[model samples]
Target: MTLEQLRALVSVVDHGGFRAASEALHKSQSAISIAIKNLEEELRVEIFEREGYRPLLTDHGKVLVQKARTVLSQARDLSDLAQHYAQGVEAELRIVVSEVFDIQEVLRALRIIRDQYPSTRLTLFVENFSAPLEILEDKEADIAMVAGGEMFDKIEMTRYEKLCPVSLIPVVSGCSREQKDASELTKEDLHGATQVVVTDRSRNRDERKYGILETSVPWRVNDFLTKKQIILSGLGWGRVPLHMIGDELASGDLVPLSSSDFGPVEIETYISRTTNHPFGPVAEAFWNLIIQRDYEKTNKITVKLQ
Candidate 1:
């Protein structure tokens, strides 16, 4: 019933005996036993079987102990949240990223954030197309890294920076009928071919489709990875990020299928915050980390050019 009683119950289960629980909690063994007894009486369940040298948890005790651990974790999180606010640190940082952007860079930035601010909860939503922007506009995300296109022009961002350019290559499985020895295939050749495309995760279904052939049969998927898998399985042909299909391209498992209308599509990706909402200390630090990484990358490219 009480947190102390729950703590005592969990401690006994974790440390394996009444005396050990007392030692761990810095309480007397009798006090620990009394706490457990009170908890068991209140719940009207036998918590422990005191038959062996070490007390064994009853079936009811095991279930209650798991629940107790969850309660204790949430209690600690509440305490941490209070402390974070007192220190001007954000309790949570949510980032909506497009799947086209390199995940390694995002993972590296997250690792640094995790090390620097352990208490700040980080939530990352990897979406395709205009979904990241939709989440940002809805105020569900703090920052978004999305691919730039006509849909991107509609948003007015409070903060914006170009991240990188991603190239989406039109490809098909080597085993597919569309695969030919010629360097290029015409639009007529792929008129009826099934094209796997990632569906926008946004509420706005009217968003214009990019790099899609109007005549091709459409097969919609939720993510680029799934789209790539479908194409690899010879189920369909579609455009995927060049970085994602590098190995498959090299192995000839996936063959590039370029036409007048279908070829490599270069998309400029950007990281931006739409709202003017003031960022907490942790969010500011994370934003700076991303900017710094971009700066370093630019400098490296500039140095090579020099």
Candidate 2:
């Protein structure tokens, strides 16, 4: 019914009994007991069953505890927000991005952020697929850019906006003609061909592929850069983000592959921030600028990694 009553109930459940709850909450056993009793009275139902040696939450109590935890979490978020505002310009902005975003766009935007907020620190985390979303959920990042497919169907976040579609191209090493030059290649044509694919690094998500043929040999790499290297080595064929392969494709170092199954597929990318945990001033400004940029769709730029 009240925060105090809810906290008391949670403490009792966590610590196993009234005596332990009293010790944890720094309250008398009678006060703890009264708090639980009052909550039951308010709800007009028993919250705990005392038939066993240790009192167990009634089905209702178990359900309410989850709701109580949510309330507590939100309450803490509110307090943190208040503290953030009380402080002046945020000292740092932490950003997590998936591999699909054009690196040039990101670097260009970083330059602008640096000029605008000279005193603020900028931290960038480059991850693949669902890892960006996971970092955001863990409160390790203030903002994230990820593939639209990486987002959960049921997600509650402060904000989300789709950016320009990122292009994906199927390519093979220039030398391996195993199935290259096929204008309309099929799963059967590419069967048993080694396919070097960028794999999801997060253990929480299921493995996914963009252009895998049913019969292609799968060679997994954790990042696009590594995948590009593997493909460039004439070891396998795979679909890679267009931004990452522009130079290779332009130089004929990688041969683009087309199939009856599909052509160049574009993935929708989104910028997301957590709900309730509002971004501080610097992060909000940078986020606004990132989403504002009119980035080139394909062949954006060739970012040479040092």
Candidate 3:
């Protein structure tokens, strides 16, 4: 019935469960459940199936959620516009970023905006590549930062200057004798080596192409950073972002295996917003700041590396 309730419903659907949605919304699980229940009662429809612990959306629930999204989007636009007009600045901007982009850079950008804009509040959502795109397409986020691959036809995307492709180099800690030196690493080096893999099951489509993951023992991790940690602890060897492990590599804590590139798993960085969607002035200002930050980073990298 209320916009807040509508948002809670959509968040639950977006996150694929109640607990995740609760975490995202910063509300109690019971509060989220109550909001959805109240909305269902007001609409007189069984929006979600109660049979499973993770409630599945009913056919009618899907339709209402779509309608709710539009309604809430409009309501949010109105609020943003009113705040912009009254205070001469924007109220808040919610952005979703993929895991590939350095999280510290994003935080730095926000801090710069706080110093410059002074009125804008920022909310950051971090997820794997696919989830960020979903949030951008659904208009849930004002803007999204992604490490690009083949361009998706779903939304209008602006490619920023390409950041270093997150090279997925095989790495192992000093404790792993088999992976001590980069030159000693070879295709045969992987044979029987316990491999650590970072998987976002929701978005991983390479499983079919990779053919059955061959490992006598393997560790599956959800977070990319965790995968790096496991590798550093000598539990197993796995590919990691080249930029992420620069410090470890410098300190000899971890070493790359094989001089051959991992076929360049280049992750291009991009900033995207929905086509033809309205943005408040604060949103525009924040967008400019993001662009400026990327430009500065590119220039800095070029200078240091070149």
Task: Highest lDDT: give the candidate number.
Answer: 1
lDDT by residue (tens digit), candidate 1, 1-306: 888998999889889899999999999999999999999899999989999999998898889899998798567556655755687877789999889987888889899999999998988999887788888875678888878655666766556778657889989898876677424887777788798998876765436667787898999989999999999898988889998999999998999875565678888888888544556777777788888897898799789999
Model 3, span 67-103: residue lDDT tens: 9988987786676557667876657788998887777
Residue pairs in candidate 1 whose N, alpha carbon or C atoms collide under 3 angstroms: none
lDDT score for candidate 1 against the true structure = 0.82
The order by descending lDDT is 1, 2, 3
Please report, in order, the local distance difference test score of every candidate based on alpha carbons.
Answer: 0.82, 0.80, 0.73
Q: Return the TM-score for each candidate structure.
A: 0.65, 0.71, 0.70
lDDT of 2 by residue, 10-49 (tens): 8999899999999999999999999999999998989899
Q: Model 3 off-target regions past 4 Å?
A: 1-69, 149-151, 155-164, 201-217, 261-264, 296-306
